[model samples]
Target: MADKKPDSPSHEPPRGPILVPVDFSAHSEAALLLASDFADGLGCKLAVLHVVHDPQNMPGYYARMAGKKTLTRMADIAGEMLDEFMAKVQKRHPERHALHKAEVLLVKGIPVTRILQVVEKEKASMVVMGSKGATGLRHLLLGSVAEQVLGLAKLPVTIVKEQPKY
Candidate 1:
């Protein structure tokens, strides 16, 4: 038998799917497109995630007063919205056939925490998300989910900024 080269690359399959967080914004569309490209190039799966922050978790006392029925209804609506959003994305980016294989997920919780949890749970190879690029008081008060994910994620994270139409 011929001796094999020690340094030859092994043809191992991709380790995990690429995770994309979509908030159904223009920025998120851009990120989704970028992720589609990555998934196609890497021959890996794609997972699209949308996190709906619970209104009951808001700081205001009134916001925190949501009952179980209200919370359940909200979650159901969010799930429907997520489904519609994914359908739109698929329709809009028909050329990106990799998106057809995407697994869409909807979860309720703090956005950043849920995102990270999904990444770990799914064994994602990388994360792609959009940044609204909020600044000043808004950034300080609301905080940026993309920024938090970038800081906390153990895997590679790509943040795509929305491009102006004009």
Candidate 2:
């Protein structure tokens, strides 16, 4: 019989950078919490990314107007939401002053593509995100960004699932 050796020690990647995609959901808050420890342990910087997918990207005359209005509203909301979220994070963890230097980004584009772009641009060692596990029609028609990123991202991804109790 072959003897089983002890499992190898798991090692976190060298302290580089962490990219966290936040949609201001509770699930995302959980991910950010996990990301905090990861950043602390790895001694890396954490950057929060918020992507605004243009709802109307069509090229027709009316479509152009629709796209403009939609994009503008989305940009406004994104900016406000990011500000609030950043304030909460700062309040939640004041000790991690280093992490406070994190960047809060708001970009408009396809979620997966934009996420990958930021990851590459930041040279992130890992990505932390939330998963709603959207089901049935929504899942079929509009796939979850987390799932898409999981499939396409080259970096390690940690998905935070929402819990019922909290």
Candidate 3:
């Protein structure tokens, strides 16, 4: 049922996978690790999703060289990054079986919109994501994804900060 994805529309709400949206930041890493524990404790699957967002001013994984610009396939780049990130997370916490068995999903769109959409489409039981805890003018202008998701998401959303390991 974990890999069945959107096809399983009739899936029970409480039995759906725990969705973890990762931005490859330290906070997101923490969220993934924590989500693994949640999944294990609940006996639910973990679905790790990465959104390939490209702003108007600068695209995702864009490189400018000698007045020439090159754009890598955002999906491709995001896929590789997501794979590497999952690997790193699993390596760091080898005991997290849920992390090792997480279902990987890649989608392209605005982070907040895509995330909420994924929640509905995948029928996620809950969302565990990281927040940078942005404040001041930056937060005013570019609100954190967590804040937007919190406001918009219909399901439970857990925002986690980076935890330092001793």
Candidate 4:
């Protein structure tokens, strides 16, 4: 049997799936592409995660848009969006089978906190996310999810910028 790494006692190349958090942005699609490549190269599973976070000003956006008066059904709406997003990903890259069957996970919380929670819960080998980069006042106020994840994640974290040509 092959020996396991000091951090991973499973004797597998990766102890857990590669957790990828997407906000349904162009950069996220790019991150998914690159994460798929990493998963393929490492022979590990992929867990596509979408966190349903409502901004302070727009709470329950999904529930409201879905014609519900409450936030209770937001998870259902988010699931639908995740489904549509995955379908689009499959359509966009018909050749990438890794993206086709990735495990989908959806949760409701703040993006950064939820992301870190997932890494520990899933025991993710790494995290790959996209960054548009926050600038000026936005940087000081909201900061960037990638930067926060990079600073906090104990495991490897890869931040990919959107590459239109890629």
Per-residue accuracy of model 3 over 15-98 as CA lDDT, tens digit each: 888999998889999899888999998889999999878757244342322124235555766687788888888888889999
Error of 4 at 78 (Å): 1.4
Model 3 alpha-carbon miss at residue 29, Å: 0.6
How high is the lDDT of residue 84 in model 1? 78
lDDT of 4: 0.86
Candidate 4 segments exceeding 4 Å error: 1-12, 57-72
Candidate 3 lowest-lDDT run of ten: 60-69
Cα lDDT of model 1 by residue, 1-166, tens digit:
9787899886765678999998778899889989999999888999999887865654332223234345556666666666877888889888887798899898878899999999999999999999989999978987799999999999999999987787
What would the C-alpha RMSD of candidate 4 be, to one decimal place?
A: 3.9
**Candidate achieving the largest lDDT:** 4
TM-score (C-alpha, index-matched) for candidate 3: 0.83
In candidate 3, stretches whose alpha carbon ends up further than 4 angstroms from where it belongs are: 1-13, 57-71
Tell me the whole-model lDDT of each prediction, alpha carbons only. 0.84, 0.80, 0.84, 0.86
Tens digit of per-residue lDDT, candidate 2, span 13-118: 6565788898777898778877878888778888899887765642242243345466656567667777888889779888875458787888988878999999
- Using all chains and alpha carbons, the TM-scores for the candidates as numbered come to 0.80, 0.77, 0.83, 0.83
Error of 3 at 31 (Å): 0.3
Q: Between which residue pairs do clashes occur in model 2?
A: none
Which parts of model 1 are misplaced by more than 4 Å? Answer: 1-14, 56-72
